[model samples]
Target: MEPPELRRAVAAGRVAASELGLQVDDVVVVHNSDRVALRLVPCDVLARVAPVGHLADSEFEVEVARRLNAVDAPVAELDPRVEPRVFLRDAFAISLWTYYEPAESEIAPTDCADAFLRLHAALRHIDLEAPHFTDRVAVALGEVNDRERSPDLPESDRELLSGTLSGLSATISTEHDRDQLLHGEPHPGNLLNTRRGLLFVDLATCCRGPIEFDLAHAPEEVGDHYKGADPVLIHRCRALNWAMFSAWRWRRADQMPDRDRWRATGLDNVRAALDRCHLD
Candidate 1:
């Protein structure tokens, strides 16, 4: 959705929440992309609104977070008063979560590693159906191939992206590495260092994949703290993540707040990944 449309949808979501008895005094946008995150004050709720088609994914995230909370895992929790259900308003789907105050200092690598181990243990026991991590790669591959949709991407870069994705997809598919429930994007940005402890916020991207996939987004020092994690697989997953994000940025550059900067950085990301994987 366009920026104007997104803002309107989020505003509508806030209004819907108000109707539902949420005391929302102010709405501060935490992030905006395929999903819009609003920090609702007074009542202290975080509203996540995505496109209608993403209702299932949003609901799934709430369910996953609630279940993880049940097991005393370090994860963001949903609002207890409101039942976990998708709130449809306008063209968006919204879900409410209990908001946490950000910690004054960033969480250390060791803290992140320890928290992830606990979260991973809880996630593995979840029986809900989830897509493989590579399925997202497949979607990115499709977007990169849509020249009409991503007209800004040069033909040279397009060919490079296609070839790079194909190789990574094959490698990811045939790897003998053990698979497990992954946080999907366990980078520091998604992690909140609350007063309670380190809690993960974005659950929409959770999926079944190698633990190394989760570590790929973390700092190398953080990966080192994760005992028994394969360094080689972590290296490969890092490359895969770059490829995925590169394709996504290339596809959505026009809608981005800083299109030129994103494109330049995304091109660099793709080039670096290819060189690292020896695919260049």
Candidate 2:
């Protein structure tokens, strides 16, 4: 949909601007995206709306934002007023999460460790059970489909993906004891540093699953393949997600020669790290 139609719908009503303290002339369309922010207009107070896509649980983001507001995690300190809202369209989940104020990246290990402990505790309490391959699997697989067209992806690249899929599939029947909601994608960028210290912003990826998902995804150190704030596991996950993310992005646009190759490299790196963890 073009921005005009969506923006028009969002502007057609009197939304409760009290949260944003918008003056009558203040910008009502403070944000715009294919996601469900359009329905946040005054016209639809009961339901929030965003673009139609994966993981649009109309209620999840708001619930997550509320919990994040209450939790004392480091990522919580730097997030914007996260008032996520849910909406339904054509039987699709649509939600919106506000982007916090932009600032420099001044994150530290203290914040990572502190946020990790707090989030782990939260996941321990929440209920997260599942019956099928998670949405991420869908997204990851979707990327694999799009990548098939590239003329240069090596056989090994395809093999690595085969391994990733197989590993993920094997876990489908393997259940864990402790279960709770988790941010399947937890990285440094999801957190911010601000007056509050560290604030977590993204919750669209939250799902019911093993608490170890967060623990495994959490930033930690490895004697090897080290760089930035993310530890080895997080680094590996980052590479995989990036390959998937890049594939998705590339599919949206044109193709890149280096893309398929780099994606393969990322997959190999991720698998190596996971091997170190004995999870792959």
Candidate 3:
């Protein structure tokens, strides 16, 4: 009835269907495209497909993750392992590394802090290098301005996008200029909880950058709206950073009037975050 959906039934299990060659009657629709995750019932092995455009990056990330998390690594030694590894794909923005696996978890406060340190530590030692991440961010920024290309966006949003980029360029140029190995996009969704402490998946945006750029989003800032495996407080300073970052992003995406966009959605999200624990 329309253009193809991306990774619609990815890690939710359809790929498992292919690998298992399950009987035709066994497949169930767990999710639809451009929406929440799906649940494919009665599936033993969960298999997922990478988003079509993200195919290359997703594949690259999986390879890097497998290599970085290889047998000899301390992350593996310290973390739990699953037999016959399985990962799931869920369209353009998300990918499931693995799930519900268990591990000796860290204390609440130190969870993300320790995880960030550990992630950077592992990244520092990994032999594999993921470059194009810079190019990806650039492209994604351009997409924010590409209204005609985005059916969900309007013309006003396109213009607002232009302004946001200008602001982002200035702020990031002066602020996030440091070069450190980072998880790239370390939002809450990127971190997974397996038996072994917390395992990070979704390295699509992984790259070299100011460690703050990644750590800034920590469980508190990025996942402020919801609960995650990591314990967190509503730290406004960092939370504001993420809020502005996103407002500028949406400002570019919807091309809304400059002030209204941020004040309404962007600042609002930030405010919600700031009010979360009311640190001040």
- For TM-score, the strongest prediction is 1
The sequence of per-residue lDDT tens digits that candidate 2 reaches over residues 152-181 is: 445566555646654543453253334466
What is the TM-score of each predicted model, taking all chains together?
A: 0.93, 0.58, 0.58
Predicted structure 2, TM vs. truth:
0.58
Give a tens-digit lDDT track for model 1, residues 1-280.
Answer: 5778787877877887898898988998888776778888888888988878888888888877877788887888888768777788887888988889887987788988998788888887777677888788888888889987777889898887777777776787687457777778877788888988888988878887888889988888888999999887777778778777777777744455666787778778778766766667
Q: Please tell me which model should have the higher lDDT, number 1 or number 3.
A: 1
Q: Considering TM-score, which of the candidate structures 1 and 2 is the better prediction for this target?
A: 1
lDDT computed for candidate 3: 0.47
C-alpha lDDT of all candidate models, in order: 0.81, 0.47, 0.47
Task: Please give the range of 10 consecutive residues that has the lowest summed lDDT in model 1.
Answer: 251-260
Rank order (by TM-score, best first): 1, 3, 2
Per-candidate Cα RMSD to the true structure, in Å, reads 1.8, 7.2, 8.1
User: What's the true lDDT of residue 126 in model 3?
Assistant: 70
Higher-lDDT candidate of 1 and 2 = 1
RMSD of 3: 8.1
Candidate 3 regions with alpha-carbon error over 4 angstroms: 1-46, 71-98, 101-107, 132-134, 151-160, 174-177, 221-267, 270-280
